[model samples]
Target: MTTPAKPTKNFRFVTGNDPDFFKDKKIVSANRSFVMFQQAKKPCDGIDPLKPQPQRVEKASKRCDASRPQPRTASIPAGAVTETPCPPGMSSDDALGLFRGDRRARKRLVDRPQPNQRVLNQILSLKAEDLPFATPNATDMCSFYALLQTEAAQGVLASRGKLTDGQLLFEAAYEGFMSTFPLRVVGSPHDTFEVLPKFKGDFKSSMEELKCHCSATFSCPNLGRTWIPKATSSKLSFLSTLCISAAHLDAMRGERSIWAPLMGQMIPLLRIMTADRTLNTSDQAIISVLQVLLGTMIACQEVSSNIHWQGLAQLVTLRGGLLQLDPVIAMMISIHSVESSILSESPIVPEYLEFLRQRRERSQPGQPIRYSPLYSNQVELMELRHDPYCSHNTYELLCDIYSLTNLISIMRSPIAELKNFQSLDDMEAERQSICARIACLPSAFSGDSKDLSRRARIVRYRFESCRIAALIYSNAILNGCSFSYAASQITPAFASSVKKDPAPRQNGRNTRSDSLPSIYRNRPVTITSYLKQLLARSDTSGLWGPLSGVLLFVALIGGTAARENLPVPTSATDLGTDSYNVKDRSWMAAVAVRCGVQLGFEYQGTMEKTLVALADVTRMSERCDSAVVEGWRASQEPEILEKSLHDGNGSLGNTSAPQTRFTEATTNEIHIERVSEGWPSTTGQADPSSIDWGFLNGI
Candidate 1:
């Protein structure tokens, strides 16, 4: 037996006991064994035995080891709109027509063999890297590499879960945060604004020297200028890459509104890019900040911001101040600042309107900022400047009005910029600067209401009404002044006073002995009553006719101020914000409803978004539980989550928008539902606990 075993050992085995042998190899040397039934420790919905069960748990590093996000697809590059129009029977791809001239060719067309549009696109889209600006410097390369690292890390994140409910995240037990998209936007070798702007200056110039910086992000084109935002090309800078990606994701969020996952990935990258103190004021850095801000506005179609506007504003200030900023962008920032002030009902740092005033002075050296006497508060309304091609006057006036409301807001609420104040004087200086801003308003239309056209008069009345409301609100905040006092304060006597004297006061001192004007000497009237009477005397006769834009601003300020000091409704039954009774109809609610509806905004999200916009633009804000607050007459049933299987019943009638009917109500007691445009009114009170904060201004 020992001799036979020794002989066997001398011969090598053909297969596995030598590795693949008894290891369940296929056929005679099969490696794996087949089981009749695949079993889990417990029952599950999973169709695959290898896959983790839905109920309890699964190992992620094993089962959920999804591939990293894919590399970005080649984006369709866009060039200047000057290309030859697409030929007949062809699509936009043929927009640049083929060389259909004589086959003999005068000088031989480019791409002679096959008229390729991409050749033209390549030439047009190529960034001249040889140029000084395009050439990579140390900082740009560093930023590019850091961004690259961030992208690589972001790609490693597993995205293998479903978010069944409305709320934003998906859960993979092993990984903290998971996304649904298999692939996300990643930086590519070639990426930039799909639709390039016709550069007005040196196209190769760096951002700081570049003359044409459209407010639109490099990820997209100017809103209505093109049907949709085009894909990014290779022209964009690394500093703005994160912002553009974030914005592009926002823009392409067609049917799905899941921004949480996208924002989660991008925000960290943005923070990383902006974290370094050295890059805070860098040109590309500022561009990144502004792109995020502008991108947010473009996506939501709302001027109000829920992002880092303070950091953005700081970057703008550090760079060169908003005055040196692009005109369109500067104005938008100024408006946003003013609205934000109103929303938070507090002061923003370094008042944005100061930049506007400086811009005005730079544009017109001799003409000083002039104040409108129609405003009880000082505001720089444009009266002297006129341009047939542009409506700078209206815009300037609106800006001033926003600034004034902002001032009033500051007086009422806690200032957010206080932490940034270098000294206590900075606060007082802010107040003084606000006063100066008001004094700078153009007053050409303030003095002579009689000289104004009917159209002009209507406009003046509407806006001036806002001025009065702001004054009243400020007065209330300061001295708890009554509506009558508010009415008396709005005296348009400055022009008359100047005309009567024909002499500049010795030291430009106000010499008036009586605070109350002559007309109000013996009369007792409220602002709301006075405004109604004045409107009655006007050509339009009421707050009716063409309405949109700044009218919402007026409604919030004027309506809130005009509302007689009724005790704010504490109970669900008490709803009227204004009296709609005949003979004493304040019409404040009516004006609010009319202005809100005239906005033509869809019923959904109107309340939240508009409320937010009004607060920003006008500084007038009111509290309402938008989520629970039903429309004119909506009803809802609580969703029964426990019961997943239903007998398949149709949903209840659409109580999404409420209904209303005219009825005689003798008392001031009325439904808040009556004048709601965005918020539908319900018969019962809304739950105060549920509120949507999307549109709320800072306050």
Candidate 2:
């Protein structure tokens, strides 16, 4: 071998004996074999065989010497390059060709649409940026926008025609305004009244103003009225509506803000109306204002203690002082009297009874009469006593007066009954017992007879006062002015003494005896007996017994029938603090009788009658037909039990059937058989066939 000639630097050729050439050839064969093996494998194995392998030949032609090196070639342009020959495991024009042909394959992928085209085009189409400039003038722009909104809202409303949501929204807006801007800078009370009509703005303005005003005012009434009829009337109506709205809004919001403002305005108004005589308002007006004020106060959630309830108390005090200034108004004062007592949670019965006691004492020979500013003149205010309207008005007023007085007395009754206990222990026990009794007392008992009686005495004084008030009002209604009549009713003589009794200098013993009733002389009485008597005798006849006769009885016998058998205890100690006050006893008496009678007769009786009627109907149906009776009887067994025991069964009957079975022979049969067959010999054998057990045993 001419030793294979060395190849030049730029030329190479493969020789049959070369190592790289042999390695290349082996790899090519191995790859071909792998292809064939893959092709022969199942299609499920996911391989293709018989693919051609690319032949690796030296850049130089095969005619070159065996040891020649391959020359390097310049890179081919991507587009100019023809497809590479198939490798041993890959076919020409395979999956790679199809992948390369796809134009999108080499381009960048995006998660969303392109910003410049899709998103920007969509945004431009919306024209959102043009909205602000569409209406350039400030006011005009606002107005136009509002109009559009209003139109939109109206369209919605029209679509849902007659729905409550719109109305509710309107109301809420109105309420919010009233709450915020309660007080306006009106010129005067008259101007304040005038401002009320301005609230009815057009729908759009109304809603906006309402929202603004509610934020501004916060529910306080503007108290500017000077008690002029028109002014007062307007203010009252306005405040009433405002209060109602505030309460409603607060309730809806579940807040308590409205109460503070309402109370603030209401208290001052009540005090001004009650105390201001220069205002020259009628008793009806005064009472009406007071009533409304009180109702509002009660309905409010929070109340301020700063308001002068004490002043209100003095205004309604029956015996003397402020209430005495006007008799017709005094009658109206009874309404407040009851209200104050109830709000104070004090029993009014004792106070009224004490007044009665004092009155009785004053009528005695040696005792001085108690004087009140109300009874100044010997001549009664003719205007108050006999007015035609007075009777009816007094009736209604008395009902409320007595009702509240009775309620207070009942509420304070536990303290009232404590007076009769002997020891502290006993008193405390009784107190607890009373507390328990009061707890057990029906809510219906609050205004019954006993309670009414304590209230009645006060009512009687009120009635007398009303008689005077009615007389005054009648005079005013009839004559248009009754200053002389009003003055006469409050003249010096009448004001100095409540009753006509000579001062107690003549008979000391008789005066002392007549001062308080015999029963109340030395000891306090049990409240129960006093209450019972009061309940039994609260009618008109009992209340309005002749004054002269009562006076005469007190004078001559030194005891008035009114004080005859009060259950007052012997001493102050006996009358423990817990004993029912006269007021409480009176109230309890009234409530007990009223509730006991009404509820006992109406509710219990009606329920019993209903049950009886049902039973009778059921019985009649069962008895009228045999088949029905049998069916009914059968139904009664389990059906009745089922209905009755629907919730749960109680207990079963004693005679219910046994749940188990047992079998056994009697001893008498064996004896009888033995006797019939002749007795067996002791220790001796007996014939087995000789036994007559079957016949003897009667099997």
Question: TM-scores for all candidates?
Answer: 0.28, 0.20
Q: Give, for candidate 1, the lowest lDDT window spanning 10 residues.
A: 690-699
**Tens-digit lDDT track for model 1 on 257-320?**
3232333443554575566666565555554555455344323322234446867867776767
Candidate 1 structure lDDT = 0.33
Best by lDDT: 1
For candidate 2, write residues 490-552 as lDDT tens digits: 111111111222335355432223322222222232222232222223332222222211111
| TM-score computed on alpha carbons, candidate 2 | 0.20
- On TM-score, the candidate that comes out on top is 1
